[model samples]
Target: MTTNNVRGHRRRLPAIVATVIATALTLTACGGGSDAASDDDAATAGAADDGSFPVTIEHAFGETTLEEVPERVVTLGWSTHDIVAALGVVPVGVPETWGGDDEGYSEWFRDQVEDEIGGALPEILNYDDSGELDFEQVLALAPDVIIAPVWGVDEVSYDRLSEIAPTVAHLDPENSWSSTWQDLTVMVGEVLGRSDAAGELVAQTETLLDDATQAHPEFAGASFVYGLTLSDGATELGLYIPDDPRVRLLRELGFVDTPAMQTVLDSVEGGNWYGGVSLEELDTVEADLFLAWSAGPEELAYTLEHPTFSRWAPIASGHYLFFEDEALAMATNGPSPLSIEWALANGFVDKLADALAGGAVTVS
Candidate 1:
């Protein structure tokens, strides 16, 4: 729909996560105590699914149990707040959305929290520069349960938070933030004793995605590469692995995961589900579409003008989806029951259709 041109740019997050082998190695040694678990069992047995008191959840670091339903829940990672709110409970504390509007709230999430809490927002939990959870702030909230199913909490971070409350760590060992929307909903539902509601929410979202893809059959079998960074000095392109929530949504919509990209992921992912490769090496870099985060008009334009960028088939055909809005960029970052609808209401579906029909827009 729109267009621009420039020379070179690299869109990357500040903290590039590497293998956390050492951090996870100390988990059992640093995990929490039974006193808090026992206390939770005694105090919260009133909140259960048909007398399903004392639900124990096992995650990457360790197992956490909830005795009664959590009254003062605090969500540490992305989009879990949306899940908690959808299940009819507002968290006592949530982190400000780093990729959202200036108010540190995603547009969709902001609207939901306001409506649910009668215009009251949850307390802000902060992430440090290196993306570490703000433990001190979480402690101050005095929450009953800390749900972070998609968080990248190391053993030290887990034990430290567990000292305060039962901490639910990541569901997958391969990556901390790679839990899918279903995984999150079901896990959080068990923790909150709302399993039926969570299952319904998951079904609704899956239907929404299925309907959209059915309507736009062109998206089927369209291979895509979700890239956020292209190394400034080298020809390396930072690609999100298949496990990332963002890529998971794209695949859900019927886009084929390029075998080339999958192979690259196996090599560099180490213990985490993210990796990068030199653009010069892969004939596999080409895909039916290229979805990316644009730093700005000028930066994206610069990348487009570069010879290296043109080497990819998608770029040559202008089959790329560029997202300039931070909220839109993060629309699927945590893909909860609420956020999936947000992406649908936004232009994600239409953009895919447009790109499939050879829509060329640099401005987004």
Candidate 2:
């Protein structure tokens, strides 16, 4: 059994710092306000004067105290931008979204910025394929604070970013991506002086998930295995652990993990979110339903026709769900208040219901 190890594989800070220094040398000194604020220009107008500031938040890289509500904010990592936007604070800089709209923004985020907030998009910071932050770009933004509660910010990166501005790293020092949506929202709210508002938002989103669970009684006690099948002709079947946000969301919807999933979890080391099982042993990981995401239609077609995958119980019995829409898949995999609402409105729950009805479904 081969394992796809993703833990502690991030590029060390010396290499990242060297790259940033090299990139900084070529860049001209431009004003930070060129594309920092939204069209409305009142970035902090929506922030409540709840006396939540002068707050110290403990994170993976020690503690950071915000003296006042952040006016010029910058967000790194997945979902931090979404959470900031959801809380009515327009960020000066945000990480570019992968599998998002053409402009490197999520559809829900774009709608919120353009239609709801009546603001222009923030500057999109570039990151490498390995999810390394562009330190030079972040430094150029001259932000008041850097929010990154769910990113892979190692000690060195955190210290460097702190030199630029007070930076918040992950909640757990050991696990880079362990913070749940609820924990992240509360932390963001505290930073923005909107603790009450954050609590309300959490409750509202949870209510939506609860409503779905109550509405779908069949999901109760059902077994499920969520994973991915590579289009690159890999010999292993990737599986997400229960702690993964996607699997946690499924569990919230009343699904339970299977013994096969437990086996995978038992084999996984700390800090890794996923594992893999050989295709030859696919039948051993049986469950009432199987779920996966495909890169596109061609990838889905390839998996369905693969000799070994074709014989898997879920595929043969038509009890499987596949996502062909990258945006929808991103919404579930990295959920936030804005994305969750957009997902439900755009048939995320319905797709699951259709799959649970005992037929293979490929959501487009």
Candidate 3:
């Protein structure tokens, strides 16, 4: 029974309806039907040609556009460079760190970005003690546009970053990493005049996700607990409430969460949020599949060795699952098109296969 303290870190979204309209426009941008009139039938294929119009977008951040291909684009926040690079637009600069240290970006993303775009790592722009973005350094980079999707930046940060260039923020707080990836890919595509490539990448990723999900039908009809434990031994259990992409993904696998987990899930109020319980109350989390995350190696060790923890029915029944930081992070935070396939290939597929096979292997 652990309280989900991490929910306190929930993203703050704009209350203004303007943000909603912006989101719709961004989706249209992603779908590849810009308002600009193009005479070339080839342009409708999501390509740029001699008749392509000058596209300028105004959003929550600010207004900016591309008369032609932008030379210097700056990507902000965590892991957006992957989408940009996937669309063949190498960012001139990106945040060296996502939050504080923590390797900031995923290994798969870093390798892919570096492989596609050869350049020095971008400057790290985050709070230095008092929680303030280094706007001066960002301004120095002089980027054509800024792509930020991971963290929920405040209005001030949004304004400042927008001043440098158009800054793309998360469309909705509840939306997962995959939504951010799709939105930013289109946003970057618009600026770089690579909408065709953007559409192709999105299509490709959709296909990959479809194939991966179809490969593991055993995951169907199972419910799971997706969450993390902090250094203080507190657990942040993902209730997998309705509308959450993870829950949606699980549903796609032909599985449903156990009634126990679903009970706690229904108890969540205000939003598709969570239920907080004490570590002593771990029994509340009831599911056929248990997936927990540790902040690091030490946390994981403590969880496995704890005498009281072994008494938990799930652990005792061998339904307990624990993931290292990497898998945990990827499962929750890495929601890109590539990420879905990566998650499947890396271990998710095998785990489902084993689960379906009724193997005695413990999920490590």
Best TM-score goes to which candidate? Answer: 2
Which lDDT tens digits does candidate 3 get at residues 248-285? 55555566765666556656676544554445666766
The candidate maximizing lDDT is 2
> Over 4 Å off in model 3, which ranges?
1-53, 56-68, 97-105, 117-126, 173-180, 230-285, 305-313, 325-328, 355-364
User: How would the candidate models be sorted by lDDT, starting from the highest?
Assistant: 2, 1, 3
User: How much lDDT does each candidate structure score?
Assistant: 0.69, 0.75, 0.52
- Backbone clashes under 3 angstroms, per model: 5, 0, 12
lDDT of 3: 0.52
Model 1 poorest ten-residue lDDT run: 12-21
How accurate locally is residue 163 in candidate 3, as Cα lDDT from 0 to 100?
74
Q: After superposition, which runs of candidate 1 have C-alpha atoms over 4 Å from their true positions?
A: 1-48, 116-119, 128-132
Work out the TM-score per prediction: 0.83, 0.85, 0.69
Report the lDDT tens digits of candidate 2 across residue range 264-314: 876676689988888898889878888898877677778888899889887
Candidate 3 lDDT score at position 113: 44
